[model samples]
Target: MPQVFEFKLPDLGEGLTEAEIVRWLVEVGDVVAIDQPVVEVETAKAMVEVPCPYGGVVTARFGEEGTELPVGAPLLTVAVGSEGALGPVGLVDSGSGSGSGSGAEAGSVVSAVGSGAGSGGAGSGSGSGEAEASGNVLVGYGTGAPVARRRRVRPEAMAVPAAAHVTAAAAVSAAVPDAVQGPVAVVSPLVRKLARQHDLDLRQLAGSGPDGLILRADVESAIRALTEGAAAATPTSASVPESVSAVQPSRPSVAQPAASSAVERIPLRGVRGAVADKLARSRREIPDATCWVDADATELMAARSAMNSAGGPAAGPKVSVLALLARICTAALARFPELNSTVDLEAREIVRLPEVHLGFAAQTERGLVVPVVRDAQARNAESIGAEIARLTEAARTGRLTPAELTGGTFTLNNYGVFGVDGSTPIINHPEAAMLGVGRIVPKPWVHEGELAVRQVVQLSLTFDHRVCDGGTAGGFLRYVADCVEQPAVLLRTL
Candidate 1:
């Protein structure tokens, strides 16, 4: 008998308590190695691929994709020492063997690596001879290992007809209805829910998916058949042909509403929900005030171009405008440390931070996210640029961990990317100030004692009034503007 170990969702840091299942990487009966990511989850902070710590055959999954599970909730069960794990029972309704599909049986073992595990030999997926516990995994996540391969089932097992197992499971389900739903030939919980909503007998319909797997569209078609047939004939009359009506669903309660409910409700539970909560909290607690200044950014643009072209052919990666601006923010923060502090409301005091964890806003398909660059004060422009680029890519791909998105002392939001001139953005909660940059465009300005068209940008500083008076905030914004208007001014800090 294999010792079954249950793994719960680990504590994703930064005070995240729950995560929504984005996708499942492994299915039941697949062999998994220790520290292998089994499911990708989206938490309040970021998207994370959670690794299973126990190496063994996956027996069951707790929640379906799109379901939210709280921390410490059961994630999956692994049979750690089983000689072989039972395969999913093949299921087919009484649909004349048309779409009946076959899955591996209980006596077979699936392999995780190469073409070898397809043979179903005992004790596979461990990489070693036997399975073992995971080591050196960062809490809640693993160090990036080679990506796990999907397990393969035996070819011969798939050739056998599904009816044999269906009849057997039918008999077994008679006695143990809870343990087996005949594996149902349906993989999606949403499809199962749809079938249940209409009380449809899944055993009667042939699946249209590969190997007779039931799909949402197939279930929906069944529902439409029942609905159309019901509407064509009154409750007192009419009929469907035996051949066509045989597969038609018996239930009709969920077909449609007499009235159309036009309102579309989108649940705010994931990234969008998190943003709402944070923004609300920031607005309620912080007495924030905004100050704006327009600067001639022509000098800053020229300095960036000169720096990028200086080394002559091998000048390395060009420094980005945002990166230079980040460096300037750091220098400005050093001059005015008050903006680098957060108020400890409970202690009724302001705590000045020593190191600058700078966060920059990035817009991604998932939503707007701020990936923090750690110790920005310690990094030069090139280093900060590289880190920013890496974090931005990770954010876009939804691979950023919760830790990378939090712990910021200040934020730099460049709304200029959207072609907007300015925004009074909300401060990220727990942080004291945020710097907003508008688009740098050619504009008429007074330069060198004469009016001329110069590359110009709008800079706005939104700070928590509780932390400091306008003097400190204005001074910080002025220094940053000076640096942009005259890049050589930064040399004093250097």
Candidate 2:
């Protein structure tokens, strides 16, 4: 018996009601296992890859890739055994056992079939079993819908607007697809990413998605051709460093001038849009102040260097400077609980957190993603380092879930990697404070009237002044400096 399961879109946070399918990793007839990523979903903030929850053969994708699907809407259909047939993208109230998108059609409201458990019927529309016919699958199963194949009729290159012309309002007001079988396929995120990478005009590339949707593969194929042509013309003897490779003279400049007429309004709908809102809210709602201090990290550096050099069989993951800092900050927060609190405007009170959930700021292609390292105070330095490594990779690949990105009480942004001396980083919304670590540079310091070169890093602390006073913020910075100055102290704190 061929049993089928339906996978729907999961609730991505921050009041996000829906997401646009960005790409499809699997296709109909493709066999997949539980937790295998099948679709990529582009939320208002980032592109997230959804994994499979139930292992089986793919039957139908309810919503076409590049189509905007409501949260809890069916995205994919999988056949576990020979029990039932999965329906189409758009729903049909028809009882003919053939839902070929010819009934009361709406976007993502596809009719499903199953045994008369009432669990399997036509157009249940509710996001529930047969595996929540139109809701997000578990984290292991990926998010978003399958991208449909589109065929171009004419070169409608000049029909669509430029990237600069698109806005959130425009996106919202854009024509909705009236197809009975899912919304008309639009440009996939993969296509957009590829287009940006190759400097290709998205409007010019005809969509290969269902109902003429443009997919990433389409853009990639075009980019590959363009690159191959360029490579054939150039000689292999000419090489340039990747860091400086972006400085080509022939590249067209996309500089936006400062005049009202000169500036083209780009809509804040996705990652950039979300970032703007969060930053603005943080600035307006939370009163913030920054304090800076320099710490001598010579011993810490020596310890780390020595550990790396004497690498025998280690018990756990290696400790990193970031991990050490996080552990220290978590401990310090225990002393000044005010520093680990968030303002609840709705509740009209300050919520002091009992445990420290550290949000490590990670830079991604889709702006900054802060994945939380929960219960940082309880985790050892080695465990914290491992979590950071895992989350960083997940963020980059758009595999992070809403839970992993939320519920952090504080944040840590690393500027040392960029060789920055110090900076006042914005507070991640709801968090009371953020700690910035500057580059560890050797400089002469006055010790007992004698100048000595020491490895020093500047610690910049930005805090929500509304929650904690300068005295408390200063104390937290001092405590962090002391821990970094004496790396051994962290072990005791942990």
Candidate 3:
């Protein structure tokens, strides 16, 4: 007989609580290998393929695609051991059928069917025992040795009234057909909920997903079709008598509004929602001040071009203007360390971070996300550029992990790509300050006692006034501006 094992949705880590089913990789009666990806799910952070730690024949699956399930909800059940042992008993619910004597009798039949081959197989015990699972933790399954629990069955306990037994058998028989007749081909709970709310029968609709699996869109289409059909069948004002129509106008002309389909309402969830909450909290908690200075970036641009052009085949990644600005920010932070720290309001102390985990804002289709480059103070301009490029690609592809998006000591936001001159960037909450770089364009400027067209850029720094006074903020901004005006000035610290 085969022993059925249930697998629940495991924690995907990074404080994520729930995930929506994106796609299913396996189907009922399919044989799955240990560590095989069973389903792909999308969390608030990223899309991840969850792997099953147990290898067996898939017995059942829960939830449909697009349904959000909380952590620890049963994902699926697998029956392990030989195929012959499964028999008709395997058709029962794997998760709900192991408690009663009759259910256990059916399970015993399944176990007996597999005992022939399982007896000699490695990791298999006596026919009465459960099959062993592979000790692998793909998403927190096999972490420790299984504790044995003995359950004793008494014959007297099974002596219930015949009517009661018949009632119980009828209930089991009724549910068995739904499980064994054929897979429902549905994976999302949301789709089922929507159909229930509209009083639509799911069995009547055709599925659109793989293997005729039902999807949320299918349910929604069904709803729209029913609604439109009903609206078309109903009588309109044309069918009303002229006497009634004329009397209706006199009674305060109450009109039924037509539904508009032009507007789209996107839920503020996931990345966009996280950003909104952080910005709102920052505004609520931090007394921030913004200071701006215009600098001649002609030298900085020239230095970057020269560095990129000088190296040959052995040259590293090209240093970007943002990387150069990041290098300057690190140097400026070193001179004024107060700006590179967060406030611990309860402790009444400013927590100054040692290593600079610099976060740079990148705009993607998902929204604005800050991908942090750890130990930025130790990395040079070329290194910073390479990391920024790597993180930017990840952010665009929505492959950035939670750790990559957090734990920044300071933020560098370059809004120049949008052709903006400057912005008072909100402090990336808890972080003391943010440096904003505007578009570096050719503008007339007085340089070296002469007026000329120089590449000038506006640099804005928004700092938490609670952490540092205006004098400190001004000094930090001045150092950054000096680096922008004269790239050679950075050599003093380099």
* TM-score of each predicted structure versus truth: 0.71, 0.63, 0.68
RMSD of 1: 10.2
**lDDT, residue 258, candidate 2:** 35
Which pairs, if any, clash in model 3?
A: 1-110, 1-111, 1-112, 2-110, 2-111, 63-187, 64-187, 64-188, 85-113, 85-114
Top lDDT prediction, candidate number: 1
Task: List where candidate 3 sits over 4 angstroms from the true fold.
Answer: 82-264
Expressed as tens digits, the lDDT of each residue in 1-494 for candidate 3 is 45567789999887788887766776645567777888878667665789888776665566654457899987876656543342221223322211221334333333333232222223233333443231110110111222132122121332223433344345445434442333345655446546654655555466778877878877777666644544555434444333222111111222333435323355565667778988999999999999999999999899889888886765767788999999999999999999999998889899999999999999976678999999999998888989999999988876788788889999999999999998998999989999999999999999889999999999999999988999999999999999998999999989
- Say which candidate scores most in TM-score: 1
**Cα lDDT tens digits for candidate 2, 166-276:** 321132122222222232244335455445555554444556567667676666666555454354554341453322222221135454343334433455656667778
Better of 2 and 3 by lDDT: 3
Clashing residue pair totals per candidate (backbone < 3 A): 2, 35, 10
Q: List ranges where model 2 is wrong by over 4 Å.
A: 1-14, 25-38, 45-64, 72-191, 194-265, 310-316, 491-494
Better of 1 and 3 by lDDT: 1
Predictions in order: lDDT: 0.70, 0.63, 0.69
Ranking by TM-score: 1, 3, 2
